[model samples]
Target: MKFLKIGDRNLLYPIIQGGMGVGISLSSLAAHVAGNGGMGIISTAQIGFREDDFYKNPIVANLRAIKTELQKARDLAAKVFENSKLTAKFLDILKNYTPFIGFNIMVATNKYADYVIEAVKAGADIIISGAGLPIELPELVEKGMAVSGNEKRTCIAPIVSSRKSAKVILKMWDRKYKTTADAVVIEGPLAGGHLGFSYDELNELGADTMTSRNYKKDKYDAEIKEIIEEVRIYEEKFGKKIPVFVAGGIYTKEDIAHVMDLGADGVQMGTRFVTTYECDAPDDYKQTYIDAKEEDIVITKSPVGMPGRAIRNDFMDRLKSGPIPIRHCHNCLALSVCDRKTIPYCITDALCSAANSDESHALLFCGSNAYRADKLEHVEDIMLELTEDMN
Candidate 1:
């Protein structure tokens, strides 16, 4: 059964390569995913982190990264289009060349709020949002128009962690905007970076007890089933259905099948995708995950006021156990909703440092199975490896 029937497409392979930021999972990873019969997502984040001499404005150095990333995504499209050897002879050159290129943009970013709109304008097939509540996604996307209508002008999918969150989003979407989610991704606690669960929740679920298990268990947590039922309620209320995709800590082919069995239309994977050759992440970043051990995975709070998962590294140790007072929140202007007014260090600084390959202060986001990715390979072979387990 196909889980990816958002508007028009029913992707046979429910594999959605999770989007990584700052040139981690750029166009090459996504392009190869689409080429191999899966949905590939491009992260429209500090994407230009590796642009060749692409610094013009010193004041907006923050935005310079985004420009570079977008350009990289575009350049990636060109390369994939050329390498496919499929001439522009087809009438639907886009459909023939770019199989399902989606963009994942964080709503809490200091970058442009209408980043998804820009992606739509850039001919992106879909936009996956996370990091914070994407309350204004529909209006943001509505402001622009798509170049073609293979699907809606452009589709938006907000990642949710619980059924309550799903219901709240649908209600907000219905009452405030009357728009429908093209799709939804239910991200569990196993995801990297900003987590959907709180520290207490992570602890209560036994996630805290098993940090050294090499992987976390979302299998019996019922997040996917709960989200499916919640989305069904929205469908019943609004008389429309929204496809549901599940992600977070999913690693094996059986994991994909289990989610599909539980009623998900798609599944998103982040950590394993980092091992791919087409992934735009730096060599050090990829190797870091490969070198990690089960005990190295840790859950900590983000500057955004959310609990997140990452590999325990020197930077985290410095941030946690340092003698300095961790009471500076220079960039905390309600950018991301958190209980605290400020945090010791700016999350933006840490993440940006990681994106720039500053391993000393870098924050590496990974799925629960991040330590399990032991080798590096090309995107095609990686996809085939995970899918082969299903076959």
Candidate 2:
């Protein structure tokens, strides 16, 4: 397969394993993908929820775990190389030319910029910020890099949903920070978790949140094409190629090929990876996807004031009935004041429960094609299947 170059780093496989948070994608999944030549991203959303003192002090726990997770990915990658029968020359090439570890920090998180700064200082090779337009991302990266005292460039990318968003971010960064993005992830409305589109827009496409499934190709494809074209304009301005990756509903080799045909440099997939053996989520959590049906995947309201796609379950049914009580603030979002009274439920607690495999009570987030997952498979096998035709 042809390689993808993001800044100074050359990825052997153009695919990026999307970051799933709470406790879904961690060192095990990220390291395995990186070891196999794909960019692996560890999600920083509630990353420290597993720490013993997390409830007492969530920020400190998340910061400490961020450093620990990145280091663990590096350690695991080194072990993979040392134990392999591949020649040292090729191993050395990989070690020098590629970055195996990265962090996924949502722009909507509590102390969003702080997380980016801390993650960079903790040795993240790349920072993928999403869930909102990361306008100040470039400035934070500049400061973070300076603090790290590392001469090497740490790649910064933003996850965008529309051409307007892409243009706005690129223009702002160029005018203010005098910098351009290293990469861009174009996420469509069909993506799992919090969607980029509003409820009305999503409904206008006949997206039956309760039952029928549909993919409005014309609407999404046009947006993606426009964004890619906008990126090309910046590429010409900077006299450098900036890679664009398409995400959302990408489940098979055909899906990847289709997007590449649309001028995408690569793809970022999160849901497919969740059912992999290496995914950090509990077995029952993986089982949720495997057991789901087309009708089970529904559009729901996120506590963060955004719409999300999730599996229809008893917990969700109860939430629909009335607002569930918020026992304590999880300190998940970067807001001056959290209006728990207005929100339906606590996202952090729900996701954490899902990660722990609490099927009856947890909110199960999934991709549009999650119902297609029949069983758990190895990360290596999934990667090969996705890239077999490309190679």
lDDT of each: 0.69, 0.84
Q: Could you say which candidate leads in TM-score?
A: 2
**lDDT for predicted candidate 2 compared with the true structure:** 0.84
lDDT of 2 by residue, 1-391 (tens): 2467787777777788989888999998898788767789999999999999899999889989999998888888666545433213356555554446899999888899889988888878899988877899888877888999877667889899889989999999899988899999998877888878888878865553743366677777888999999999988998877999999888888989888889999999999999988899999899989999988999888887778889999999998679888888878896743466688888888999898877776989888888999999988788767766653
RMSD of each: 4.5, 2.2
Q: What's the TM for model 1? A: 0.82
> Which stretch of 10 consecutive residues in model 1 shows the poorest summed lDDT?
324-333
Clashing pairs in 1: 3-265, 47-69, 48-68, 48-69, 326-344
Highest-scoring model, lDDT? 2
Candidate 1, residues 1-391, lDDT tens digits: the string is 2234555554535678888865677767776776665777877655554554333431144344434444555566556555442323332534533466678887766544546556766666678887767888887777756432334566778889887888788789889998778789988777776777777777766665335353335543576788798888776776766777778778877777878888887689888788877777778888999999888888866666677788888888888674323433333224445334345565645665776788887778877888888899876666666666442
As a whole number from 0 to 100, the lDDT of residue 279 in candidate 1 is 79
Misplaced by over 4 Å in model 1 are: 1-3, 9-12, 50-97, 146-152, 209-220, 236-241, 323-342, 389-391
